[model samples]
Target: MTTDLEFVDTQVHYWQPSANDWYPTLRSRPALYRDILPGDFPPVAGHVHVSAVTAPRAFLDETRWLDRMRHDTGLPTAIVGTIDPAASFEMIEADLLAQAESPAFRGIRVFSGLDPAADTTLELFRLLAEHDWIFDLIARLADVASYLPVIEKSPGTTFVLEHAGWPDGEEPGQFRQWREGIARLAAFENIDCKISGLGMALGTMDPQRLRPWVETCLELFGVDRCFFGSNFPVDSVAGTYAELITAYREITAPLSEGDRHKVFAANARRRYRLPG
Candidate 1:
């Protein structure tokens, strides 16, 4: 089973405590309260540097910084910058365009500052599609259904669901609710889900326990629409990099070599338009 499925992680974050912003959440978490950069990442063939929280004014700056980091390291081959979608429409537009100026800029991930149901949010989603940028949504399980209309309206925009809708835990009720929400999202052809970051739900990384959730996502989205993401540093609390990769490989081993390759690498490279 050692066929060539070059690893291209779709979710990795490069960050450090800046003078004005320390990524408060990371600072609070013992395992992630430090600097992480391309050098810190495992030797994957490529990766997409998802945005780490930055000060409101620093959004475009962080994008520039990431572009420079990619230039120097030849790593994080794709970059998903951040934008303050809560800002005025003009501001968000300016922020998105400024971020887009970076050669590697691919899209954005918002931890907050988005109300997909709002008029402004809907407009922003449309803008993403116009520019061919990604909306790496980070929604909680309870809020999944709320974004359906926005997603439905923005047909061309690629909406990537983060962390399997950020499952709170794997309790029976929780799993059912999350599964239902994901099923609804999968109905839209433009939506894709990341089968990463479930470690937070389990408290520890156990492939056996995570199998059902991983299988469910593939069953819903199909391998073509899904991507492999390590969610490093954050998932570091639950398991080592090697263990996480091994776990995913084992969980998806039943698929044919081409299908497994789609989940582990091809899908992301094609979705993100990453150059080799």
Candidate 2:
């Protein structure tokens, strides 16, 4: 690939699941039963070079591990550490401010458990906006609808929807739900979508099979708002890192080079404020 075609794997997890407190829950899923390190996913040896990665929140103290990965591998350009939205505003603000002090820190991620219309959740959005941090949302398909109000309320916050809302295109009524939910969420200008982690649900790395979902995401959010990600190790449960990347490439082969660049790298860099 040309230098300009270098990829930015937006979502990857480098952590020891066994040592994590959520090990019991994670281990139940065979794919996440072991330690996954930088060595596990070396630069693809020519096909695609992972120039940078944006790792989402992990099970334990994710920032400590993420900083370790950056120090160790010299990749993982930024990390979205976990946050306890339920904590007091004073506590959360102090913690987020301290975390922002790290060069590796770009934002904080929270599961979509908060009601979008709730006063408390709106306050959390304001807190993130105040810090100029991104809000990485790990939400299930059903949770997308609830986030619309939050997106509407926090117009200044850049909210990224992980895994394209975890759609299972093969399941009956699954795509329909994803289609409607995603379309609604995509309507919000502040929202962006990451095309990652689908292997965990799609069960195959066949680009042909994933084309519809991937294309729909692009069509709904457009090239500027859509970005590609490997969702590594976790996606490994269904396919290899190379396989997922190849699938993404194949699914996007028909697009114009400029559009492909946006999905493959540019969008992530711009959205996450990654260093050039």
For all predicted structures, in order, the TM-scores are 0.95, 0.86
Q: Candidate 1: give the clashing pairs.
A: none
Where is the poorest 10-residue window by lDDT in model 1?
18-27
Q: What's the C-alpha lDDT at position 105 in model 1?
A: 86
- What do the candidate models score in CA lDDT, each in turn? 0.82, 0.72
Q: Pick the candidate with the highest lDDT.
A: 1
Error of 2 at 3 (Å): 10
Error of model 2, residue 158, in angstroms: 0.4
Off by over 4 Å in 2: 1-4, 17-24, 44-60
Steric clash count of candidate 1: 0
The alpha-carbon lDDT assigned to residue 197 of candidate 2 equals 74
lDDT for each residue of candidate 2 in 1-276, tens digit (9 for 90 to 100): 223366877787665655654345554667576776667775731111121112222323456656666777775677776555566767667777766666777776765345666777788789888777888776676676677777788998878888888885676588888888889888888888988878877888888888889999999999999987777776776877777777888788889998888888888888777776
Candidate 1 structure quality by residue, lDDT tens digits, 221-255: 99899978888878887888888888888898899
Clashing residue pairs in all predictions, respectively, total: 0, 0
Clashing pairs in 2: none
